[model samples]
Target: MLSRREIESYESQGYLHIPAVFTGRDICEMERDHEFMTRHWASSGQGWTGPWRKEYMDAATEKQSQLVAMHDLHFYAASWMQAVTHPRLVEAMGDLLGPNVELHHSTMHTKPPETGHPFPMHQDWAFYQHQDGRYVDVLVHLDDTRHENGEIRFLAGSHAQGALEHITCTPEGPCTPHLPTANYHLKETIPVPARRGDVVCFNIFTVHGSYVNRTSQPRRLVRLGYRDPENPQLGGQSHGRPGLMVRGHRPNPGGLHPAYSSEVGALDAFKAVPEPALVG
Candidate 1:
């Protein structure tokens, strides 16, 4: 559970960094799983099916075997499923989202060496809109993340202002939605450097992005999202895959698709779940 000051900090700053949420043993297991998945994807030549799939494929083709990112990893690997539904994560999320928290989605972001990509400043809420903006993202660091290795930077207190307008740009040809560059200059930003096993939790409305990795080591993080069951989607956008109820009982199970409710944990067997359209 979070202390009063920690909770207050999150409410005011829109983010918090909790160190060593996972033990050394846990991180080791996660790293093994991560390595296996990366190798599998690279060898199979199965590019990501998400919005950035094209960019990922292009990079992999050019680089010969670089794995950029993976979406809905919980559906593919048991280790990832265990990590997302980890009891500690659920407890922390319960503090913010109340008792009935549901899994929104999970993603794995990999920044490889010097050529890792940078994400433009934007709000996750823009992609996954929910009523009252009752969504939070928990980023679990699988590797040491620092400014030199593409650590995410956040604009403090930006969530209080609610959602901001995002514009589409094709700076390199493949169009992507992001907040205008001018908005990035409007607030004071801070780089969130984290160690492996640390967890960084932030509000969905928080404006954040990262820079290219300059170091030779890979920086990887697994992001899991949770939301109050009461806050349904306003835009009717499906996660592409169904969401799992990880904590407490859902009073209105009907709101969730049957596919999501049927599973308890380790959803590797459910091959029918659709691939997420965007990273979100």
Candidate 2:
């Protein structure tokens, strides 16, 4: 999946871009299905909107700006399920995080042509935070991306500082937990252009953002968040949900882990309440 040099690079730099991890044909099929999936969510107010959105768009641009997305594509599309669980991807997770890797969540991050919105500089730690630094968020690219098309940018080694406080805006959107514009500038980050079938992996605490996609083609990326089994979440998206383990089995370290919450609590509650008498 990754060599020792690459792993060291990711550890020191807090990000790594591995090219052509998937096949062009397979990714194309997944992209096609992504289109198929979005149709179901159309007219569902799926695009970005809210008071905080104005920070990234002017009046005219705001009127045209749009970002199409959804969460947990594996639930809806089999191709995506296979794509995320691809041997290379899961193995890479093992290489970076640990032998036991678990998936935190997945989300669609497709940017439609011309009017695609830009994401402000921010750390993912703000959205789905954890107690430790053994987590990573991977971007599986289904289309070629470049600076002109708003490729993702990273402030190298920023994750070494650990999670920084981000400006909390609306409940959702690209910049829901963005950095203040006054200090963190987008141009200061290094752009990471990638091609179709490429995958970019970054630490959840790395400062990252992108510019608007001005091209007439869509910038397609599906985000897959993964972590080692022992690194539990403090509180954020999908908190208390012990998700799928991709590499090794989820380790039981005792004491109230999300993995045991449902099983343990349910048994205790059942014992306390006692079984109800059989009814017709």
Candidate 3:
């Protein structure tokens, strides 16, 4: 699904954006699924557990709006499972992570108008450190994202240098690695503004973050993570939830944790269906 130039760009620059890989129909289904999940969560009246969930829920409730984001939706929603396992995405992941790639996890980020939160600059590797930096994240845009609406900004070629020391601000908030704002050689960051159905793939160590949404419209997107089966978690620390093998066979017996078949049963339909031609 990726050309030599595109692959090289990802390798050399730490990221690549592919426009219109998904069709309009796909985005519509995703938007619908997101709405259904938001309503279900709200109606259930479940208390938020983790820091991220708590912050998201609190902000949404205060604003009388939808949840800002949710993680591991693929485990519950069939639409999300299909989107995460889409052939084009899986194929593109294979280009980076080799044939035997596993789904690390997936998250749907809904930045509602005006009150959307800002993510401080950080590398994903800080959260999930691997022996080899082989993990890649694909961000699928469901809405047209611009600088005014919290488009992601990435530091070019930062992935090749490896992980940096991170600082913890609050016990309840996210711990992000700090970079000197001044004298940092890679001062000029690239802003990624994408349209609906576009996707951006970035390395795990890539320095990236987004600002608050200033627009009235919501900025929506789904992030899917892929990694090689051979890359085991260091010290048995959990990154997110258990992952499913979306492409190729897993050669390592103890690589991935075992989970209930029902958790990923939704992906069966995608595997059975014939692959579609690449969309431009």
What Cα-based lDDT does every candidate model obtain?
0.73, 0.81, 0.72
lDDT of 2 by residue, 70-178 (tens): 8888878889888878899999988999889888888988778886878888899988889889999999988889988899999999999998988765455343567
Which segments of candidate 1 are over 4 A away from where they belong?
42-67, 169-174, 235-241, 253-280
Which parts of model 2 are misplaced by more than 4 Å?
A: 42-55, 169-175, 255-280
* All candidates: CA RMSD (Å): 7.9, 4.7, 9.0
> Could you give the candidate ranking by lDDT, starting with the highest?
2, 1, 3
Q: How well does each candidate superpose onto the true structure, as a TM-score?
A: 0.79, 0.86, 0.76
Residue-level lDDT tens digits of model 1 in 1-280: 8888988899999999988888767778888888887777523223222234333235643354343676677777787788888888888888888888889787777867765666667788876777775789889898888777778789999899897877643545534467766547422579999988999999989998877666788778878888987776665234433478899966744333333443434433233445422332
> Which numbered prediction scores highest in lDDT against the true structure?
2
Specify the highest-TM-score model's number.
2
Give the number of colliding residue pairs in candidate 1: 0
Screening candidate 3 with a backbone cut-off below 3 angstroms (N, C-alpha, C), the clashing residue pairs are none
What is the TM-score (0 to 1) of candidate 2? 0.86
Q: Tell me model 1's lDDT, rounded to 2 decimals.
A: 0.73
